[model samples]
Target chain A: MTERLNEDQPIFIQIAELIETSIVEGDRLANEQVPSTNEFAKHYQINPATAAKGINLLVDQGILFKKRGVGMFVTEDAKQIILAKRQERFYTHYVQPLLQEAKRISLTQEQLLDFIKEGFSHED
Target chain B: MKISATDLNKIYKKEQALNHLSLTLEGNKIIGLLGKNGAGKTTLMRLIAGHFQPTSGQLEINGQSPFNHYSITRDVCLIQENYNFYEKFTIDDILKISAVFYPNWNASEAEELVTLFKLKRKRKISALSKGMLSAVGIIVGLASHSPITIFDEPYIGLDASYRSTFYDLLLQSYQEDPRLIILSTHLIDEVSKLFEEVAILHDGKLLLHEKAEDLAENHCIVSGPVKEVDKAIEGKQVLHQSTLLGQKTAILYDQEIDGNYDSLTFSKASIQELFVYLTKEEVVKHGDRN
Candidate 1:
């Protein structure tokens, strides 16, 4: 479950998010091997070094553990840990901005409802 | 372990291809060599690879000359866009030749790539398509495991999916063995991400040689108001400034961008946009005595 990222944050951060999302979504389970840095680089069409940096971020965070001769594997509690972390980030990073912008535009509950209704009417 | 070229000069028919350009190409990185058709990119790569004798300059490969020397040539494989192969030789023949040339040649790896690329081993060199030819070139360049692999133009007649596969393969190979890779191509945006360091050549001169991310970070388009942008870029390295309908976008060169300018915010410059801006004709150099 590779995550789709915007061109905003540095790519390595998005790569970490990608692995975390995979674990939380059950796409990547505990003890499963993750793609190597070069694999990720080729898959994402990014620099191999940048890919390694992204994977290393997860390793440093304890969400992933390297097996030396083997490959990188997800930690046991990676799913739950990522879920809680992402949930908090979602609200503060994404939700708050929408609420603040809506408030700034002076859109009340009723007005927003009416606006939605008008948009729906024009679509069909 | 960076590949550094000092006072690189190439003179051909009274026209200097490389005008004493000096650049320190970083190691363990993919560098995007961006330039026009006649720019000194090919010349620079050839000079570094020892394809031709330099008029008066020095190129050290990890501090060595790769020209006409088997020792350096074994560790450095240079592939140009139009590769010259024996027309009668098949893919197997090519592999045999590679075995004699590249000491790090992995036969199994070559076989695996042949299957991955769907290239037939029995096909003649003259009969291969442009895409297939490029694929063979990629296989050789990747499997050579050279310390420095310079690809003049890796993508020729390759479809989108094939090109994507090429990028993936290049990255996958580099992770196992980090080496200096230089790619000269007109398709700047497609391969810009793989570039750790980027060199912009214009009219036989090395215009810019900076880290890929740093190059993007160092310059930005500031557009809002003529007076506002002018004041915003005060004491900054203004690369180029243009006005439209009383609004001006001054392309400023700065190192650190906090991105909280009151008049206008700064966005990262795309490698392609920066190359165009840096190499545009009539644009004065940093300090032109004339």
Candidate 2:
């Protein structure tokens, strides 16, 4: 289920990220018809123009394509494109923050690496 | 339609309702008219709807005064919280009357909304529950399709599910017919995302009118060591601050937010939080003057 928007960022950017997550999670497959802006606006209780802007951002990124008079669809390589994009942002979005948080708690790099190895060895 | 209010002032007996309020808006966009109770939101909407004239200022819709102007008034619609209807009138009667008054009224849309709200045509206005009455107002507001539509606390008794439904329908209606829509309500957090821009009122005066996203991006709350937080926000406009056990948190409204805070954690300020801080600032300043 889609959660209500948070105050951290603009709704349009969040909408774009929501769609990207759907693609990356295999919920929205490549070449599949994605929800239209109207559908998104109604579902999210947001302005239609804002939803359109989010879709347009994805279209500009070649992850989604608009079929005139029909609706938007994920590109054939949408999942791959999203994966690559997220990989490029991993350091800034997750890894750097993780390391900083570790440093704040006085956890060294070697200790963090060991923890990661232990977690991988024992799956919940 | 272009709606312009210049140096608008409204006085109710000895009380000043609106004080030199000036605003100029054109094009079609959703504007969140937000303020505390008795902050002159109703007065402003009434003036725009021509229900009441400004005591000393000019209010025009499409370059013509709305007061006593049949065409201009017809183009504007203001749905107030307390909807006054003939007590004997049924839901169907109300919709029929509205269809005759509003030039852009959509009968099919009204019928659809009535069904969606589970409103029975034979039910009298006086007998409906508060939520049902609010639903009636929502139906009229959405189906009217006026050039300028203002809703003043239109969802007083609506449930959360119904409120969300209303928001969805509002967006769909707006997309179908682009118009200047102003919503005045205290449910800022719930409806903030739906607004393109917001106009904040405080003490009967316009405090701020800006893009919703831009305002959120510029304002933030930072918490960290007192010295580090103060040093990071030096020379910036701070709205509020608190200190506890050598830790401090400050709300800052700076357009050029320097995200280089090495020792502090920052988060964007919610619209509701900004509204509270801004409105409270006025009270503090007023108390100081007294």
lDDT of the structure predicted as candidate 2: 0.87
Clashing pairs in 2: none
Winning candidate number (DockQ): 2
Model 1's alpha-carbon lDDT is 0.79
lDDT, candidate 2, A37-115, per-residue tens: 8888778887777788888999999999988998999999888888999999998777878888999899998999999
Over 4 Å off in model 1, which ranges?
A5-9, A16-36, A54-124, B223-228, B240-249, B255-263, B282-290
Cα lDDT tens digits, model 1, B1-290, are 55678887889767888888888886777888899888888888887777887787787776777688877767778878866578889988998899888888878889999999999999998999999888888888888887888888976988889888888778777777788888889988788888878888888778888876567556677787788777777777777888999888877776444445554645556677777777777848777946
In model 2, where do residues sit more than 4 Å from their true spots? A1-4, A29-31, A75-85, A121-124, B281-290
The 0-to-1 C-alpha lDDT of every candidate, in the order given, reads 0.79, 0.87
- Write the residue-wise lDDT of candidate 1 on A17-90 in tens digits: 88887788788899899988767776678886667777888888788999998889999877777777888888
DockQ of each: 0.39, 0.63
